[model samples]
Target: MLSWVVTFLIIALIAGVLGFGGIAGASVEIAKAIFFIAVILFLVSAVVGLVRGRSNI
Candidate 1:
């Protein structure tokens, strides 16, 4: 979910600011992975919509 991606990203930023190196790193990695998955899902949804004869797509 895009919201999850933003949440993890904010967590990473706050942890980094608070000097938590390991937590910051892990959070950033998780955020990156979630963002990628969200993007992939969006693209797949777009393609599927187009194929299904959706005019809005």
Candidate 2:
């Protein structure tokens, strides 16, 4: 999931460099949304692990 965000970020960078403004903007937005979701999920998982006494984390 984090890989997807990085992929979209790279795509946005390339699209912006190639002058595709609309594509770049859309990709950037997608990247931001995915990044936030990933962060939220990570935090939730961390909390759950702590509460459950999961040491593997």
Candidate 3:
């Protein structure tokens, strides 16, 4: 997921350099959304793991 975000960011940079304004804007937005989603999922998973580990003790 994080890799995908990075890929999109790179694509946006390339598109912008190539003078593709619309494509660059869209790709940047997609990258931001994916990055946030990945962060949220990571935090959720970490919290779940901590809760489960505590229960086992």
Please give me the total number of clashing residue pairs in predicted model 3. Answer: 0
TM for candidate 2 is 0.87
Where in model 1 is the C-alpha error above 4 Å? 55-57
- lDDT by residue (1-57, candidate 2, tens digit) is 989999999999999999999999999999999999999999999999889894665
- Please, what are the lDDT tens digits per residue for candidate 1 over residues 1-57? 989989998999999999998999999999999999989999999999889874654
Considering lDDT, where higher is better, how would the candidates rank from best to worst?
Answer: 3, 2, 1
lDDT of 3 by residue, 1-57 (tens): 989998999999999999999999999999999999999999999999988786534
Which one wins on TM-score? Answer: 3
Per TM-score, what order, best first?
3, 2, 1
Positional deviation of residue 27's Cα in model 3 after best superposition, in angstroms: 0.3
Error of 1 at 23 (Å): 0.5
Clash number for candidate 2: 0
RMSD of each: 2.9, 3.0, 1.9
TM-score of each: 0.87, 0.87, 0.90
